[model samples]
Target chain A: MTKTKKIPVSLTLASNRDKSDHLAGFLSISPWLIGFILLILGPMLASLYLSFTDYNLLSSPSWVGLANYRSLLTDARFLKSLEVTFTFVFVSVPLKLIFALALAMLFNTGRKGSSFFSAVYYIPSIIGGSVAIAVVWKQLFGRQGAVTQILSLLNITDANLIGNPDTALSVLILLVIWQFGSPMIIFLAGLRQIPIELYEAASVDGASKWRQFFNITLPMLTPVIFFNLVMQTIQGFMTFTQAYLITGGGPLDETLFYAVYLYETAFEYLRMGYASAMAWVLLIIIAVITLIFFLTSKYWVFYQSEGGR
Target chain B: MHSNKRLLSDMIFYVFVIAIGIVMIYPILWMIASSLKPATEIFNNAVSLWPSAFVWENYPSGWAGFGGIGFATYFRNSVMITSIVVVGTLLTGSIVAYGFARLEFKMKNILFACLMATIMLPIQITLIPQYIIFNEIGWVNTFYPLLLPGLMGGQPFFIFLLIQFIRGIPRELDEAAIVDGCSKLGIYWRIILPLLKPALVTVALFCFMWTWDDFLAPLIYLNDASLHTVTIALRNFMDTQGSTSWGPLLAMSSLSLLPQLLIFAFFQKHLVQGIATTGLK
Candidate 1:
């Protein structure tokens, strides 16, 4: 009841509360904080250091300056992997996004079994990265496999698609494109968020269905398209299991993914330092691409809150 | 006339959807069917969906595995690692999410941004160094490399997801609990956690699916044949058997995917909804 005395007491109490909140916040997040330092941040710095050294697993790291990086520029497998990964990312991401967007549009028509169809489509995205799927893909495109048998009927004899350098990467791309369900689902969700009134308004203005799609739907869906593109591109670059298992980067290292090459360098050959350098280069590549995406997003990606660009 | 046009369009839509669905699902079905076909029948009748005779022997034979180990060991390893990883993800993810969502602290926004940035960070950068650290400590060829990261924070994506879910819960609930002298931990436990069921479920399913399907980590960490996971074992099976035993190979492949298929079947809604909300893996 005494105003001056109560004010002083309340100020101390508020400060006490703030102190507890700080302690509690830190305590609760300690697991992640500790992990971020030890697992991610520390390892990141260590890898950067290791990149300059010539350490195998057994030896002490001996610094070789930029030799490892310089060697990477001339490393044929490294260049081949860059080419393979770039091709995969450029080809598969767009094709996957196109298929996803098309299927998403098809399902968004409010047909009765659309959900069931979507669920069925999603099954592959769940298991597509597994060894089992890779094995299935190999067999499906192998010399004696079903695809060859079908193609042979059309005079495409002995067409071992997976064993051919020219078609091997495409086979992996097809497998990846087959698992377009996740992005399709994301697209479907984005489509649902587009208000029905926009289409209605477009129709009232005598806009054709194609016009409605271009003016109303596509402009609205650009954000989702951008999200899918960035994620799928990143994922496409890291694709290892399919190329590793299906082609073994084979016939001429045609399907050698960057991650697969890095794995072989580090674990298989025990070139820890060299692999570390490759990892850093990969990180830089991913960072640059993601930065480019974010920088470009402003021009194309429309946020409803921004009322269009 | 209008009704007829609508009916024809509907029919065409159904046919297109169903046809594409079949094409999409064919490889999976083929694998399942091949598992039951005889070795000769597997390739000779590759185009056929129906097996002339169901060779139930493939399952038992594939289960026998190689190097004196069995599919049973691989499966047990997978289940153990996946379950522990899922539980760890849920616990750490929810706790960290609570901190970010409810409590005001120094550098909170910066830390949250750090967490989000990690969601896009490629694993390759950390792979070699983490392996070095584990190898230095003689933790290589053990589950520590695979398990510790999950136990620590699971994934930044999971934490980000739970944080989004936690923010949606009314702050009044936390405040009322505070008035009752409930501690911050108590509010996280009694108020936030119970309300976090759906999001936790989404996290758990994803964690389980990803961990189970994960090949690279197990491939790097668990080298001993006895310590191999289902994915690694399947790869080994393919390597050793090559083309001699397609039936048993396909059998094991199908068996390996059974858990994922079952999870997807039962929790389709949760999985779809999780992707819709987070737009993440």
Candidate 2:
């Protein structure tokens, strides 16, 4: 963690201060450096190594030479987990973003008590992922749950959302959509940053509200939308708590998320090497997905600072 | 006629807003209502907000949790864990943020970039290795595994947040302190730390909420039922057997929502301000 620095004699005092400044900086940030080494960097390298080997924690890791990655090609459960995670991300992210954006627009109308309602709406995102919430959700969609009762009132057939394999994943997606608060808040903030003058000018030009929204508002919000897309996609992919607690990846493994599967492999099944490989694959997938988003962002994500067209 | 039309539109919009608000909060309201219903009446009256009978015994019975461990233990464990973790996050997050925000050090840019990168890194990549490390040290089944990493500034998000905040403070303040014979640490303590109260509160609030609501870490580390968090304790009530007491489970579940709901209610402004300030950046 050391580097060489050349200092001119004319700045001797400043150079002397530079050495002390470096020392102070290191001292102040040493906790993060220590944790980064021990918790982050150490585990990262170890996982990378373990991804290439076979180990079950009791024995020494024996190098398997890409065996883990090779095995994933034919591993049915592994493939299933990937499919499930992709489905979760692809379905939940857009729905959550759309809901968030719509709510943000609704709350951004300068209506009275909009902030209070916004805060109330943000409550689910605060506590929605808890084991308690997951349990509540499980019951709410259970055979005798309120959802069933409501549907019964509407003359729809009774169905158990959590117990039925075909509809179990949709329940989880509904939970994700329910917690669109954080993004809504961010979208609200982004809406505030959009100068009001554009909307006023559009109104003066006889533009309708929808026309003003598309022509003036949506373009200005592309950056924030792009930001939410990447963040929520990552979050959607990493979602584990609800599936782990509520679904247990069950009703025929219909909801076996990647993280849930990874946990089962490492701890439940004690296949550390295989789990590490799965982890590495997940990392690569997320990195590639994020890279794609960044690469594709140029065309759609407009910045006001760049003089929006 | 135009003004009347405008008033009508505003009224419709307000009605729409209130309808959505009910959709957002109905599940929670249902839980609270169900908690007050008799066990036999829970599912029968699930859709109704008014209970046929107010079962006051549910709260006490739920408090006397499964196997007699009680919800009190879980609540206390949560409090102890969250408080320590919050203190550690604020202290370590602020100190490290100060370094990144103000100080020039070797490899500063690269280290800062790594910090930012790790903020987006999925926890799965490091999960197994960290588990092994904690296992080797015999920190399994203890709060150590849960709280220790936080003490070492393991939360990159909080550090990044506090860095953004500290960076916004004028450098002239630090310069003045230095001229008045303030050491670097002195300036951090006397000048910068005071100004960082709002950000610190934000960090503390987030730390408390996340740790309190966290299920995976406690479920993994604390295998003992007595050592479980409220989240895990709630899970305990729903045994695989078909004999789950819905009255007590929903009661405890409603109680579990209390702390966070209270925090959000009181700190509504701070929470909104924090997210707005941090997000827009």
lDDT per residue as tens, model 1, B148-267: 878876899999889999999999999899899998999999999999999999988999999999999998888899899999999989998967988999999999899999999899
lDDT (tens digit, per residue) of candidate 1 on A8-78:
77989988999989999998999999999999999999999999999987769999999999999999999
The clash count for each model shown is 0, 0
Candidate 2 chain A worst ten-residue window by lDDT: A1-10
Question: Scoring each candidate complex against the real one, what DockQ results?
Answer: 0.83, 0.72
- Ten contiguous residues minimizing lDDT sum, candidate 1 chain B: B272-281
| Candidate 2 per-residue lDDT over residues A108-180, each given as its tens digit | 9888989888998888888898877887788888888998788878887657878888889998999999998
Candidate 1 backbone collisions, by pair: none
Provide the lowest-lDDT 10-residue window in model 2 chain B.
Answer: B235-244
Model 1, chain A: how large is the TM-score?
A: 0.96
Native-to-model Cα distance after best TM-score fit, residue B244 in candidate 1, in Å: 1.0
lDDT of model 2, residue A131:
75
